[model samples]
Every structure is written in structure tokens, then in C-alpha cells.
Target: MYRLLLQNALRPSLQKRRMKDIWVWNGMRMTEVDRIMLGLRQRIKQLDENVVILEKEDDRNLYGAISLRIIELELAEILALLDTLNRTTSNYHHLIIETTAQLQDMMDTMVALVKFDKMQVIKKEHENQQIKKDLEKCKNEQKATLPPPTLSPGHCGLGQMVNVSGPKTYSLTAYGTSYSFGAWGRDVNPAPGNDKYWLVVLSSSNVYGHYVRQYSTLSTLLLGLGPTDTYISSSNPTTNTIQGPNMVMYGNALYYNCYYTLSICRFNMTTRTVSTVALPKDAGYNSKFPFGILGKSYDYTDIDFATDESSLYVIYATTGNFGNVVITKVETSTTPVLGETWYTSLYKATATNTFMVCGVLYATRYIDKETEQIFYSFDTKTNEERYDLKIHIRKMQPNIEYLNYDPRDHLLYVYSDAYIVTYEVMFQ
Candidate 1:
């Protein structure tokens, strides 16, 4: 009889233990539900706030449109959840489980938001492409609307060159030939004691081929370009060589390079003689080790010279085991001679690229994990080392594939692969 009584008491205690275990499990679940529901409520509140803000603003730009879409999606989800809540009976345990499930749904919505941000990157790239196309159209239209010329300047096709006599604007002296390439005009004043004369580089393609003219503009008439004897002919079968000269004016001379050989040349306006400068010889070609000249390899394409009225500095790239871009200074004071030691790049030759802008030479080189962009200010007075801005990449467009700076307006123009852009740089 006593054993039976003890067994009954043990059964009740065991049952009570089982009830406690069930309560503990339910308590843990309720805690998880509370945290998850709180997170859901916060996210929904944020989304609602965003929807209100987006509704009030004008969505002319891209960000506004994206915000609007996100708001719409969030509202749709919230409405669906509200419908479920209204239909369902709200007992304590049931309410907890339902709220936890709703929290999971909000988490999924947040995941979708993250994915949308990633997709927006592609959208931004597309917008950049559209901007580039619009810019190209505007440029062509501007080219077409230039005033008609009054007189034929010479054999060269006169591009957009305007002559301002006092204040009244006059039509540019036209070119006799139908030339398609563009030309740029600059006032070239030779070193010490020469009058300021207009230097015009004109490019054109004809039945014969392509021709680039270097003309001296004293009056409206173009004094014969080049040596009055030597003429420029297109050697590259791939390109129309007369597609407007890529001429950069230093102090007194203009510098450019030929495509086939990577040879750079300079023309002294006073002497009227064109002379070639020696470039580092190619290490020779191998089937396994062929070199590719990236970007524009045409003459006057990828080279920039730093100079004043008296001296010229040539910077060009050559390829070997690595790529080599050599900076050699040439003193034109007596005989044209190489001065100072050459600057070997810290990185391998293939790892770096060089460009010059606004009397400064900028190099974009590959760093360990990042691309290192630095500029060297060439000083003529010291006749020595060029100063470098170490690892500096602010306020300058290092990703610019093509860069041109107008000193007159201090407007820096850069053309990347996707877009042509402009920046106003503050000089220190």
C-alpha cells in the first residue's frame, strides 16, 4: 500500500517537471519573437518615413526614382501583413508566433532593399553613357553652327577660329578645302624678343590620304606650315593621320610622336627645321612576348612635353620585360643634348602610365592594392629633380583616360571611357 502511494506522488512530480520544460521552450521562442518583431517594427517605421519624404519631393533625378520604388514595395508588404493581422484571432501564443513570422518577412524585405542598391550601380553606369551621348550630340551641333567664313585662309580647312577686331566680331577666314578634322589655335611667342604670332595646327583627310598642317598665322593668310617644304602624310593604315594635329605648345616649340616607331619629334618655329629625338629602343619582338601599345598610339597621342621658351623635355613610354616610361630633358640652348639621369619607375614598366597637364607631368601607376597617382612639377630654374606629390589623389581626375586643361579659364576637362567631364581646380 505504501509503495503504491509513493508511485502516485512521483507521477505528479514528473508531470510538473514536464510542464516546466514546455514553459522554458515557449519562453525562449517568445524572446526570439520579441527581438524579431522589434526589428520588423523599426524597419517598417523607417520605410514609412521614407515614403512620406519621397512623396513630397520632386523626383527628377535618379535617387528620387529609386526611393519611390522602394517605398511602393514596402507599403504593399505592410498592407498585406495588416490584412493578415485583422483576419487572425489574437490569442497570446498565436500572436507571438505570427509576429515572429512577420518579422522574418520584413527581414526578407530588407534583403531585397540591399539587392536593389547593387542593381542601382548598373543603372548609374547607364546614365553616364546617356550623358556622354548627349554631350557628343551637343558638340556636333556646336560644330555645325559656327559662323561661315568670309575668306579662304589657305589650303588647310579652317576650324572654329574666331577673329575679334577691337570689339566687333568678324567671320573667320575660311579654308578652301573641305576638311573634316578639327584644329586648335594658340598664340606662340618665341623665347626672348619675338613677336606674339598665332600657331595653328590643322588636320584633314583627302583622296590622297591624310595631311596635318602646322601654319604660322601672322595675318588672316596661313604662311605655309612645316618647313615650307616638308609635308606630313598618313602612315598608319588604321587611322586618318590628318585627323587634327594633337599639338601641345610649351614655350616656343611643338612636340608630337609618330605611331609606328614610338618616335617623338620637335619643331623649332624660328629654325623651321623638324628633328627627331632618340627613344629607348624596343627590346625586340618575340611570339611569346609581343608588346601592345595601349590607348592612342598615334603621333601626338600619348606624349606630353614640359618646357619653357629655351628647353624641351620629352616623356614617352616603351615596353620590355615591364613597360618603361622615360623622362629625358633636352637642352636646346646650344646643341640639343640630354641632361641629367633618367627616372626609372619604382614599379615595373607595364605597371604604370604617364600623362602631362598644365605644365605638370602626372603618372598613374599600379600600387599593391590600389592605383597610385602622383604629379611631378618640372622646374626649369633648378635644372634638376622634378617635385612629386606623393600618393595624392584628391581634387584631380586620375581615372581620366584623356586630359586637357585650358589655362585661360582654368577649366580642366577629362574624358574617361564612359564620360567627358569638367572640373574647376583650386590652385594652391
Candidate 2:
């Protein structure tokens, strides 16, 4: 019984030690969990702060974008208003200048009339004095040699009635080409400084290729030049061959517009070499349709080639933007280079064709058969537009497809679907 009591006491002591160790281990685990929970709280606070900062930044960026858009809108409005005001002011200034010019013209006309009346009065006085002197001389002659008896009225009537004929009729001999060069002739230009009156005709055929024919005169025989295929060298071999629709000859070189490549092809007659000049970036060409179809159809490239007194020029506009014309002067020596460019508000699509006369651009449109042909001219010298020039075309056709002004003959040539006509341009 004493041993049993000792064993019970030892078991109690062992149980107490085990309980103390378990308590120490749980205390250490509780301290680690508390440290982890505190770190989590601190991380959560930092995340909240970051989110708030990001939200504020986003709001600032959105507000900044909106402010910029508003500024842009305001700036656009201001620019539009400025443009309107400038146009209005320019129109008003033009009106005032025109009115002043008219008034000045009227004053000058009045002065001219007054001077003319004064001169007329002086002239009448001098005439009267001369008449009086003539009468006195006649009287002296009559006195010197007894005046012959006046012829009887009956005899005078008999002589006057012997041969009474109407005034001689007169007729003007019409001057122009009666022969019609077939409709395929795209362009005709007079050779520069040629005594034989050489004409270069640009004609195209699938079989013969795009070629030029040189005629000694419009009436003379034709001599075919090189087919474009023989002369043109493609920059890209995979690309289709370029052909010229319109061409102008300057000196010994011929400049042509290649719609396929959107380039100007220059052929040197002397060297027999072909080179190309790239068109402006804005110059648009329609490649959706085949060349043959496009050439025959109404949808055509707006690019045109022309020559003035000084240099060659390229006239072009974008597709659907034919109202705005851009003209560039081209210099062709060893290579073709674009020179001075001019922008015009004139709509090129409205006209059948345009040509340059003494640096002035002229456009023509077809009206009815009876009405006089109308013309719109833009003078490059003064940058003035005149839309009131009316010209009469005899036996006018319904449609005039091409109108070209030949500076050599000072004649305007009109090409209809069937016939080619020429008119003498008389300037007052």
C-alpha cells in the first residue's frame, strides 16, 4: 500500500511535465500565427493604398483626354471661323476693287466723250471753213469757164438704169481639215520648230502596241515611231507594261502619262531611250478595271499632260476629288524632275478637256448644238479666272471629247467622236 501511493504521486508529476511542454509548444505556434496575421494586415493596407493611387491616376488621365478633345474641338471651330472670315474679307475686297475699277472706267469714258465732242466741234468748224473755200473756188471756176449746162434728168436716169445689178455677192472660204482621222487618235501635237509642219499623233492598238505616228503635215503621209513596248523598261518585271494615254513633245524628248504605273514616261527621239518619272503621292490611278475597259469608259484617271510656252506640266487630281486640280511643271533632261506646282480650285471633271494657252489654262464643255461653245480660262499670270468667254463653233456636234489649243497655229482644235474640227482664235 505504501509502494502504490508512491507510484500515484510519480504519475501526477509526469502528467504535469507533459502538460507544461504541450503548453510551451502551443504558445510558440500562436506567436507565429499572430506575426503572420499582422503581416497580412499590413499587405492589405498597402494594396488599398495602391488601388486608391491607381484610381486617382486613371481619373486624371481620363480628365486629361477629355480636356484635350475639348481643346481640339475648340481649335477646329476657331480654324473654320478664321477660314470663313478670310473668305468673306477676300470677297469683300474683290467687290470693292471691282467697283472702284468700274467707277474709274466710267469717269475715263466720260472724259473721253468730252474730248471726242470737243474734237468733233473743232473738226466741224474746220470742215465748214474748207467747204466755204471750196464753194468760193467753184464760183471762181464757174466764172472763169461758163458752167456747163446740167444734164437732163431723163438722160441721167437712162444712163443710171442701163445696168442696175445687185451688189456683188461674197462668200468666205472655210478653213479646216475635212478629213477625219479615225477615233483612236488620242493626242495630236505640232512638232517643235519644224518647217514641214510635223504632227505627232498618239495611237494605241493591242496588236501594234502604243505608238506614235509622225506626219509631215495633217495632210501628209504618216510615219510610225517606236511602239511603247520597245522603248519602255519596267522597273518591276512582274508589273504590267506601261502605256501612255497622253503625250507632249518638248524639244527632242516626248513626255507621256502612264496610268498603270502612275508615272511619266519620257522617250528621247535622239537617243531612243525611255525613262520614267514617278508621279506625286497624291496622284491617284484606278487599277480596278483593265486598261482597255477603263480607256473606253467614263471612269478615267484624272492625270493629263500639257505643254505651255515655257515648260511641260502635269495636271492631276485624286479619284472622286476631281474638283481640285494640282498642276506640276516637269523638267526633262537626263532625268525628269517635278518643278513648281500650282493648286487650283477649278473642277477638272466638269470639262471635256483642258489645254494651256500662253500659260493660261482653258477648259471647255459641250452645250447644245445651237448654243455657242463656252470656255473657262484660268490665267496663271494673274491667277484670275474668266468664265464668260463664248466661242462659236460651226456645225457643232453634240459631244466634243477633246479640245486642244495649238500654240503654233494659234488655233483651237476640237475632236468629236466622228470629226476633228479647228477654229481660229481671235483675241480682241
Candidate 3:
């Protein structure tokens, strides 16, 4: 018992002594490291400033290659010192304070370098800006020297209502002409299932809503419109009220929606017959609460599909009784049913809607009222909220009439009464 008491009594004193030694060693080492780091940081800041000045010289900057090598060597020494200090530090609390101070110094130095570099670039580009403005002015002056756009007889020919798909090259079903929008980028994939190219036009005639399909080829339409072998018009025009015929060309089959009943139909390119598939059920229409309305009960302003074109999403608004604007998505491969349907109820004073650039579904909610502005982003993935962006215009001077995202260009296309504008958006 005496021996046990003696061991216990000495343990605390021993531990305290060890701890004191550790603290002292850490303190001395930290003091030296701090001094070294502070001096190195000053050197780094000076070198960084020199780097910015040299960078302005462009080709002359390459002459400072030796100076850059020296700066890199100094930066390496600072990093090595930091690693050593980090390993030697006794506890995280003190280490954090010291590291934070060092990081702040580095950050401030970096920010200064960035600012100086940007200023130099701006100074260099100022001449370019002036030249561009002068060139535009000269072009405008030359506009008075030239004639207006000549209108040929069929310059704006109604080639028939066509849908375009694929890369930079767009396939015009009506003309059977695939043209590249830009000079360099172009790709082609024929509409799925149909070997013979066909022009499909959805006609909203007084008597009936029917789809017109005429067969042609890329060469035939581009060379000359050869005779159409088959013309498939809707046989049962009464029941199938097709509206907002945003036709999509999946592999070989063509698909479009009938808005009123909220049904999607697939047409075989060969047989050319319409059959209904399960999709979102259509909403009842009223008009007082919405900004705009489509003419037919089932016709909608916008319909979008996802990136893979595997999912169909549809949007339409009605306002007469202050009913909700509905948004729906249908997974193409899955059987369309109530169990498979996804929807959101957007109560409206006014709402203008559009899909995301990649067609990952989203709705920008906007309501203009007497007192304040309101907006929200409804994400379809989680059936929850993505609170990043909000659209409010009442408090602002200009009101937005339409919002659309261009998946092709990674641009947000906004249309207002006074101006058409584009904003860059990160396309993930």
C-alpha cells in the first residue's frame, strides 16, 4: 500500500514536468518559426509585386525568367518552413491562430498580385476597346453607304412547322435539310426508326387536329422536293386534341403531346400511327391570373425534355379563377401512371416559366402584388426548394415578360418589353 501511494504521488509531478518541457520546446520553436515565416512572407510579397510588373512586359517578362525562378525558390522555402512548424506545434488551438495569420498574409499578398495583374491587362486592352468602338462606328457610317436587306420572293418561305435536334447541325424535318449553325462544329444523327426522312407538321385546323407526315431525304430536300410517298393525317381527329405539339425525335420514333388530356403519343416513322402513352394529366384552364394563355385548351407555351432527352417535362399556366400553374415530368422508359407522375402546385398572381439550360427541371416563381416582390426556384429533383435564385421585378423598374435558358450555348435568355438580354450561367 505504501509503494502504491508513493507511485501515485510521483505520477502527477512527472506528468507536469513533461508537459512543461513540451510547452517550452513548442514555444521556442514557434517563436523562431513565426519570425522566419514573417520575414519570408515579406519577401514573397515583394517578389509577387515584381512578378506583376514584369508580367506587363509580355515577351519582356520572359527575360525575367531567372527572377521568377528565384521567387519560386523563396516560395518553396516558406512552404517547407510551414510544414516543419505544423509538425512541431504542440496543440491545434495555438497552431490554428499562427497558421491563420500566415494564411492571411499570403492571401493579402495574392490579392494584391491579382489586382495589379488585372490592372495591367485592363491598361493593355483599353486600346483594343477603343478600336472596337471605332470599327463599329465606321460600320454604322457605312450602313448609310449600303442598301437594306433584299427580300427575295421566297426569302422567308414557310418551310412547314419543323423541329430541329442534334449537335451544331440541325435537322429540319420539313425541308429534310441539315445545316450547321456555326462554321466549324457540326454533327448528324438521323431521326430514330425511320430510314426515309419525313416532314411532320401538326396542323391545328378548324375541323380537326391532325399530324401530317411526308417522306423525303437530306439530299432530296436539299436538291429538290421529290414526291412524298405517304401522307399520314390523324384518322381520329375528334378525340385526340393535340396542342403544343412540341415534337421530339427519339431514336427512330417521333413523340408529341396532346395538352388537354395530358397525354403523350408515339408515332412509328414507318407505320405513321398515333398511340397514347402515360404522361402527366392535363390541368383545367382559366386565364385571369396568368400573364399569357395559349389559344387551345390543351395547347401550352413551353415543353422541355432533359439532357438525355429521356424525360419529358411540360408547363402551362391558367388564371381566371386563381388556380395553380402546374409543372409535370414523365420518365419516358417507365410506364406513365399516377404512381410515376411528379408535380408541383404554383399559386399565381402572375408566373412566367421556363426550363434550365440542360433541361434539369426548374420553375422560377414570380408574383407581382401591391406591396412587395416575390420569387422562388423550385427544383424538380428533390421535390424541394433550391433557394439560390429568385425572380422579382415589381420593385425594379423593368418587368420580365419571358424567361428561357439556352442549353446549346450555356446562356440564360431573358426577354423583357424593352430589351432582350443574356446572362452566363454555369452549366453543370
Candidate 4:
């Protein structure tokens, strides 16, 4: 019992020594941690500085590249705009020259009509005073008559699509339902003695095409003869090539939808030159709002080119117009430019095809494999629409891939399932 009491008494001192040792150990441990944290803080500061430098350097490089790209794009746009202006001015100069010639011809025609043929075929004035009087009388008559046209414009033949008959399948294509989509027509306003019939066949994908085959005559196209000229651009889906199957030849220019662009490509076969005209800002392209019904759609055919009595029209839908069909008149004297825009109430996706007759826009829909019905019409002259036209188009195939009216022949040229067909349009 005495030994146990002595051990307990020494235990308090032993416990005090252990507590002191623990306190010293903890102080050493804390000091080491402080030293480690100091090293880590310096390393972290260095890393932060390096990261900031990298970020700033990267920003500088990107900013320089971005600014340069923006400048390049701006310069390119300015160059294109200046080029267009130059072209338009050159066209105006040509117009002035033509106008002067027309004016001289018109004056000569007036002189002939008024019996003032410059002393030829008319009685010569006997007295000098009478000659002056006769000249004065001619001048007075000229002032009294209506002035001649500054430009000798062609007569406008405007009418509605009254009735359509017979799907006479033209023997043109050798594709034979394998291609199944294309566009074919004559020039709406052919220069004298232009018997060229153009055919554009899409690739097997039916999304884009680049080849344009021109037959020398209708017989050549019917006989499936080799083309007089075949223009093949840089492969399929290239920009400025025939993108969609909806196209038309008018005034020696091939107007069609351009690939990778919401615009019209006017390719002049005579000059081998190309021009582009931009569509509306909200115009739909890239298979958006194409001609279709509830479940089926014609792929990559959002743009349709049509011709009337004296004008070329572009049919398209716009997001701003709620996917409704909009027709814009295109002027093709030199570079194609937008003339006038007409909006229709018909939905673009609801129609299977569309065409222009005289000054009216007609929309068609699939009724069956053998017949498609014209269910709507929009008169550009009157800015009116009619849905009761109900003109049925006879078809040799199920789908009409492309349909356009040739004002030159008064025929509807249809490219349906690899075959070309034509129908004569009856007027109202």
C-alpha cells in the first residue's frame, strides 16, 4: 500500500512531463506547416502570374486575328459593292446608247407618219417662206402628238392560267428515273432563232447539281442526243452552280438558286459571266420551308424561278412572312436585280409546285400520282389571290420535281421523276 501511494504521487509529475513534450512537438509541427504554406503560397502566386500572362497573350493574339478578319470581310464586301455599282453604271451607259438610237428611229417614224419625209415622198415646199411654215407646222404636230417611248419596250402579254391539258412527256433524259429530279425549259425570251433547250439533272442525292446540258434543238433533246454544250462546274454542291432543280432560262441567262447562298445566280451563257442577287434577309433556304404537304417535302427546292410575259420572278418563302410564298420580280438586263416584291397568302410548304403565267402566280398541289391540281393563284397586276382556280395538271409520274412556264412557247415545262413533260396553258 505504501509503494502504490508513492507510484501515484510520481504519476502527476510524469503526466506533466508528457504534456510539456506534446506541447513542444505541436509547436515544431506548426512551424513546419508555416514553412510549407509559405513555399506553396509563393508557388501559387507564380502560377497565377503565369496564368494571367498566358491569358493576356492569348487575348492579344485572338484580338489581332479577329480584328484582321473583320477588316478583311469589310474590304471584301466593299469590293463587291463597288463592283456591282460599276456594273450597274456600265449597264446604264448601254441603256443610254440604246435609248438614243430608239429616239432617232422614233423621230424618223413620226416624220414618215406625218407626211414629212424630208422632201422624199412628200411635195417639196415651193417658197422659202412656205418651207419655214411647213417646218413650223411639223414641229407643232410633233408637240401635239404623244412622245415616243424613251426605250422601245416589248409589249406586255398578261393573262391568268385558265386551263392546263395533257402531260406530253418529252423524250429528253437518259437518267431514266434514277436521277428522278431535274429542270428543263426553253428561254422565256429567246433572242431571234434560239432553239436551245436546257436540261439540268440533279445528283443521285437530289440535293444539288452542277452540270447543265444544252441541246441544240427540241429534236435533239427528244432524241436524247448528246448535248450541244455541257457545262460542268466544280463538282456537286458547289456555290454558284445549279443548286436546286428549279431554274429557268430567260434572256440568255440561266437564273437559278445558288448553293450556300440565299440569292439568285444569273449565269449568262453568251458571255459566260455570273451575277448574284441577294434575296430578302428573312428568306428561307437550305431545305427550310420547301414545297411540301403535311409529311412529304421537295428537298432543297425552296427557291423557284418562273417567267411571265416580260419579267422573271423568284418564288420563295420567308421567315418574316410566316413561311408563305413570296414572289419578287427580277430585272435581267445586265446583272439581275430585285424589281418588285409580291407576297401571297398561300403557304409555300403546302404547294407541290408553282409557276408564273402572264403576271399571275399559280400554286399547285399533289392530288394523286396521275394528277396534280392548281389550287391557288396570285395576280401580280392586281395584287389579288384566288383559290378556286382548281386547274388539274395531268401527270405521267407521281411527283413533279420542277415546273415552270415558258412564255416563249406558252407551255408548262415539267421535270417529273427523270422525265420532262410539257402542257399547253389555255388563257382566261
TM-scores of the models, in the order given: 0.34, 0.45, 0.35, 0.62
Error of 1 at 60 (Å): 99
> What is the overall TM-score of model 2 with all chains considered together?
0.45
State how far residue 245 of model 2 sits from its true place (Å).
Answer: 4.3
Winner by TM-score between candidate 4 and candidate 3: 4
User: Best-fitting candidate, measured by TM-score?
Assistant: 4
Best by lDDT: 4
On lDDT, who's better, 1 or 3? 3
What is the lDDT for 328 in model 3?
50
lDDT of 3 at 323: 55
Candidate 1: misplaced stretches above 4 Å?
1-247, 270-272, 283-303, 307-311, 319-321, 333-336, 346-360, 364-425
TM-score of candidate 1 against the unseen true structure: 0.34
Candidate 2 C-alpha lDDT tens digits along 308-396: 54567777765444446666788866688888777777665555556676676765555555322345666565666666554434334
Evaluate residue 83 in candidate 1 and report its C-alpha lDDT on the 0 to 100 scale: 38
lDDT of 1 by residue, 1-428 (tens): 32234336445533543453356456654454344344545656776567567656765765776876776576566555443432332344477699999999999999999999879988999999999996896465334423323222212132212211111111222343342212223323346653343322342231122333333442432333342222344353232122223334445554544433344555555564456655557521111122123442222333434432233566544455244445567655423455653544422223233433333344443333322334333322322333233332222223333333444433333332222334433332
How much is 36 displaced in model 4, in angstroms? Answer: 99
What TM-score number comes out for model 3?
Answer: 0.35
lDDT of 3 by residue, 324-385 (tens): 54455544432332223344455433334444322234444434421112233344445553
Model 4: per-residue Cα lDDT over 70-161, one tens digit each:
44454344345434434544454576679999999999999787775656443554566688996896465434322321211223543333
For model 4, state the Cα shift of residue 290 in Å.
Answer: 0.3
Residues forming the 10-long window of minimal summed lDDT in candidate 3: 179-188
